[model samples]
Target: MSAVRRLAGFICLLALLAGAVLWITRESARPRESYQEIGLRWLRDEYRLDDATFEKVAALHHAYFATCSQMCRQIKEATRPLLMQTRRQPLSTSTKAGLRQQEQKLCDDCELAAKKHLLQVADLMPEEQRQRFLDDMLSTLETQRLQHDLDMSAHTRR
Candidate 1:
């Protein structure tokens, strides 16, 4: 009877341990892909993105998306006057001054955000990796620029 009780207690302890492990494992959550992922998907679908290019594209996009989000917020704040005054053909001088101030604030915010993000990225990445990342980004930009020029040339020829 004593042996049976000990076996039952051990089995119960094992069951509890197994349950705890399963619970912890099940609790692991998937991180949602950032807005960068959406932008990258759009690029991939619209353009021909190779594997090597896609990796860099995604990383560059992550940085750009972060910057763009900050810029968009600033832009919306800056352009609030144009959005708000739909009824008026011309805004008053005071209103124009307010708009100018908002635009200046937006530009300042964008500059600050870019500075802060670049500093953070440099801190996080190794020197070589950061250089490589920068090169990759510049290459992507160059490719896009070339494509745009070609597109314009084609349109002009037509």
Candidate 2:
């Protein structure tokens, strides 16, 4: 009877451990919020935007996200071949320069798109809030761009 009780206790502990592992795995696999969602939420909270304003902001964001996604896909498709080629062999100096130029152009286009979207959003705000919105959004965007540049430079050095 004592052996039977010990066996039951062990099984319960194993079950609890399995449950914990499963919960952790699910939590880790959950999708994180996209940049657009986070930006919208921050704007709403920071500005105390009303429902109508938020709706307009959200609509603008959704449209911009579609454009941004398309541009990113185009950039990725354009660059994939270059990346694959580089993986196989050393690129000629001219070829590497051309690739870098192409990538910079894509990056510039993305930045322009983001700036346009942010400006449009700022336009939706009241007179007093417009500058604040632009300042905050642009600051956040610039910070992200700088971090991205640093990370890319680090990756290339590796």
Candidate 3:
């Protein structure tokens, strides 16, 4: 019937619109670069680091990234069970507490690794540039941390 055809067309049009909106939302939410990439780029531009210094910094960055990536995977693996348990049934208080502690420890380890890497990079910088580099790097880290926390909170709310 003509009415049925019209109804089907309307539904298809609505579906297309919904898909477009979802695509736009996801694209907007995506970051242009990883935080580490952004930090490295910022350091290169802001400090005008020499080639040798840049190479050393890059090496440290790469090493730290590897460690961080491993930590992230471990955390994700650990959290998966907790998430599954929470979804399937109520978890015991002790189990929940243990999971939270493990998560916190993983986060702390990652933070410590980053701090050590930053210190190594700072040591490589000239005395004159060291303070400036630290100031800029700390600011960048704080901004990124705040943004990450905000994003996590928003995600959890959903």
Candidate 4:
């Protein structure tokens, strides 16, 4: 009877250990968000959006990124020739001026695209939230643009 009792106790301990291992594996397997995803998560949580609204907003967000990415590629392509020239010789004054103007126009176009997307998102927001959201987002966008300009100018001076 004592041996039987000992055998049952050992079996119970094994069962508990197996359960613990399974629990740890499941917990550790939970997926983590990448840095980029955290911004989207913040937008959802900060705006207190419902699932349906969030879905629409996320769709718009992704579309804007796609447009913005193309603008970035255009800027890169526009500069490629100048980059190649700079590697071999200094750029002519007119060439530098033309490239700078082209870059500015691309940046302006990208900004306009961003603003239009922001307005669309604001339109979908609740009436009470719409103005506030626009105000916050536009202000944030302007802040980022200003910082980017500052950084670029500083780099140029260097």
Best by lDDT: 2
Q: Which lDDT tens digits does candidate 2 get at residues 1-158?
A: 69999999999999999999999999999999988799789888888888999999999989988998998897776555455654457667687668767876887888899999989988888778889889987998899878856755554433
For model 4, what is the C-alpha lDDT against the true structure?
0.79
Q: Superposing all C-alpha atoms, what RMSD in Å does each candidate have to the true structure?
A: 13.3, 4.3, 10.0, 5.9
lDDT of 4 by residue, 13-132 (tens): 999999999999999999988654686788778777779888888899888777878998997786555555643476777886788688778878888998999999887777877888
TM-score of 1: 0.39
Quote the positional error of residue 43 for candidate 1 in Å.
14
Clash numbers, per candidate: 0, 0, 0, 0
Q: Candidates 1 and 4: which is better by TM-score?
A: 4
The pairs that clash in candidate 1 are none
Question: Each prediction's Cα lDDT score?
Answer: 0.62, 0.82, 0.77, 0.79
> TM-scores for all candidates?
0.39, 0.68, 0.61, 0.68
Clashes of 3: 0
Q: Write the per-residue lDDT of candidate 1 for residues 1-158, one digit (tens) a residue.
A: 69999999999999999999998787776466666677667655544555765666567657777777878777777666544554445667687667767765775566556555544444444454666545654566557546644753443232
Off by over 4 Å in 1: 1-34, 38-71, 83-88, 132-158
Residue 83 error, candidate 2, Å: 5.9
